[model samples]
Target: MKKFGILVVVFIVCVAFLSSYANADVETEKISLNGSTSMEKMVNALKEGLEDKYPELLIEPQFTGSSAGIEAVLNGTTDIGNSSRYLKDSEKEKGLIENIVAIDAIVIVTDTQNKVNNLTTQQLIDIYTGKIRNWKEVGGEDLPIVVVGREAGSGTRSAFEEILHIEEQCQYANEVNETGPIIAKVQSIHGAIGYVSLDVIDETVKPLAIDGIQASEETIQNGQYSLQRPFVMATKDTIEKQNEEVQKLFQYIQSEDGQKIIRAVGLVPTSNKMSY
Candidate 1:
């Protein structure tokens, strides 16, 4: 009987040790995200939402330009590259895959003090092309309109110029690298105007009504917002080809809960939860 009791105790100890080891295996992993300064808001939303539900994740996001992000993923330097625009055909040929995470509008903002509240599509084009150099040309104060813009190679710059159909023809008074600093520059400089992601706008600047339509989630969803583009994440391989932890991160982004976060940030989630 004593021998039997000892055997039972040993068995219970072994089971407990195995269970503890299994629990220990559930620890966290690190995830690296790169690219797209324009994707900061959306990626931050994803990071916050996913990290809460998955405490085992350490998500690090780097805000490089869209092209850099695509290159990073294709070169296997990072697990994911966030982009504010869809992948170009040239990038597609590089075996890079774009995963559309959400839809964002490119909004034209002037200083809050500027009286100009609306602009037609043609007028915005003229303003950037330097044909309309003064605020009064667009029905604002008599101050000279300072056209601020993103630097060359910026996704925001590409989307803005492309949608406006001006391409490299824009006559910018100043060029900035990121959305945040541009807002500050516009706030300090009178008659300053610039374009940024819709979600980044605040009381600091005023959005101009484009073609009598405001850029909002509903307008973006219904295709009424002409300045909208897809928010994307580029990967070297399909979602299935990523590591298990990376796949989980993408899964959380497409989950219903993840969509809620995107909506709360004033960007529209992809209709089917993922795209591109």
Candidate 2:
């Protein structure tokens, strides 16, 4: 339940962000995106469309972590930093701005063999912190719960920890660096559990509900599910305000066609969709 509530803050911030982009001209020739391996799927979906619309443009991307992505743009390493979570206040203080691309719910997944489904925020926190050590503690089989997760620097790990307030203290049984590996481990390993972006979920693992709210497109869009986080593209303010291409790509991500691309990738598009 606590996980769902923090999305309210994200909603407010996104609204303000869209409002700020209202008057800017959304046109550009090229865009270079780096950071957040989680955003790769979304970026790939957009790259073709973005290039088709602006035939002369080049859309390049790199799959780095969110913090590194945000820092890259700030330090002039990339035109846009693709982040899976909202920028930290510290990053914003350094003049970085968050441009939301799509909404992703961080879902807790278990091996399909594990019958335990839903978990409260506290139950999740306790389990990840090593306090609740077995599946039976959460009403499942009496097997040891194998907690798999991403590496410390992953944006998914950051969002999962920050939203659940489990930061730094997560007692992961295994900490892999990418979402794909986490899913694979959870799928093939009995009693394994992990978290991933909603868009990446597959039949290999079961996506459990939280407090009866499933992480579906409708539930996330309607604000019924709370594990959702924004897919942010961060750029330095001075550059964002002045770079026509960057603004164009950002605006396109929020436009109806862009929203379609986002939905195609299994994420919920912002209701505040903009014109191209």
Q: Estimate the TM-score for candidate 1.
A: 0.88
**What's the TM-score of every candidate structure?**
0.88, 0.85
Best by lDDT: 1
Candidate 1 yields a Cα-based lDDT of 0.86
Candidate 2 residue-wise lDDT, 1-276, digit = tens:
787788988899999899779734455466788999898899998998888787767898989788788878989989988888878889989988777767899999999999888998889899899999999988999999898999878899888888888789999999997888988999999899899999899998999999888999999989899888988877777434747887777767767888899999999776352212
Q: Please report, in order, the local distance difference test score of every candidate based on alpha carbons.
A: 0.86, 0.85
Candidate 1 lowest-lDDT run of ten: 267-276
The local lDDT score (0 to 100) that residue 197 gets in candidate 1 is 92
Candidate 2, TM-score vs. the true structure? Answer: 0.85
- Candidate 1, clashing residue pairs? none
